[model samples]
Target: MPLGRGYLALAALATTGGLAACGREQQTYCADQNGVVVPDVRCDDGSPGYYYYTGSYGRGRRPGYRLGGGSRIASTDSNGRARAGLPSTGHVSNGHVTSGGFGSSGHGSSGG
Candidate 1:
């Protein structure tokens, strides 16, 4: 028994293969330590169980949900954008959140 070209092509098209669209980007959402997707506000206000989840496979302009991983979107935001003060990159996994985003240990910066 041998595999046909059609079957091979289909398998290749599936999963993380070369056939993936070059101009495709998905929504980089925020999740909790348990990897549960929640409202953007929760992640922004430094609420408990709040963290960023980067499941975007490729780089596309359109914003969409992650095709991989296990997560349930809590709710959609009126504005599709992460609130201010929350870093766009990096994730907090220690179950300790800082309100001022990256490099913030709940301490105010002092510099004149």
Candidate 2:
């Protein structure tokens, strides 16, 4: 039996690359998207913190985020527009923004 061309190519590439052929574990606190890895901290444990992301839909993508210690905060740009999450607190969405948690400050948008 003989090795296939694809197998030979893969072998050659792997041998040449050595350790580079294997990938490393992504950071626990970060996410990799389209070759650009960024922080994945959606909820800050601190009080009154700002979380920002430069996405395709908008520049300053910050939504109202509620931390664990009953601190509900809204993220805004220099112009003060709704950022990433949603109109309310404790709301997180991957496709669309949605509202969560009853009677919390900033709690009512309804998307994801």
Candidate 3:
């Protein structure tokens, strides 16, 4: 009888340990550097959401600005002129571009 009880206790401890390990695998979501929400398999419930910012995408800009992807958009520049790009053009003043080998038209505008 004592041997049976000992075995039962050991089984119970093992089962509890397994359950604890399984609980550790839960998923969670949090914000990235841009405050963009990144999902992880180890977070708490009822967490607040986050948002991610792209080098091209910014405030008052459209979403889903993918990199290395040929895309375009129609938006106004700092001078309140219309513009477009595949991902985002970031903030361009006086039609000056820094990278991506991109050129600009008058009024901070661009096209393919």
Give the winner by lDDT: 1
Alpha-carbon lDDT, every model: 0.37, 0.30, 0.29
Model 1 C-alpha lDDT per residue in residues 29-111, reported as the tens digit of each score: 45555554444556555454544443333333122333354122222321212342224333422122322323222221111
In candidate 3, what are the lDDT values of residues 34-68, reduced to their tens digit? 33333421112222332111132222322222222
Per-residue C-alpha lDDT of model 2 across residues 1-106, encoded as one tens digit per residue: 9999999999988877765433311111111222122333442222233332222232222333221221122232222114223332433332232222223333
TM-score of each: 0.32, 0.20, 0.22
Q: Write down the lDDT that model 3 would get.
A: 0.29
Clashes per candidate (backbone, < 3 Å): 2, 7, 7
Give the runs in model 3 whose Cα sits over 4 Å from its true position: 1-3, 25-112
Better of 1 and 3 by TM-score: 1
Q: How far is each candidate from the true structure, as Cα RMSD in Å?
A: 14.2, 15.8, 20.8
TM-score of 1: 0.32
Q: Order of all candidates by TM-score, from best down to worst?
A: 1, 3, 2
Query: Between candidates 2 and 3, which one is better according to lDDT?
Result: 2
Query: In model 3, where is the ten-residue run with the lowest total lDDT?
Result: 24-33
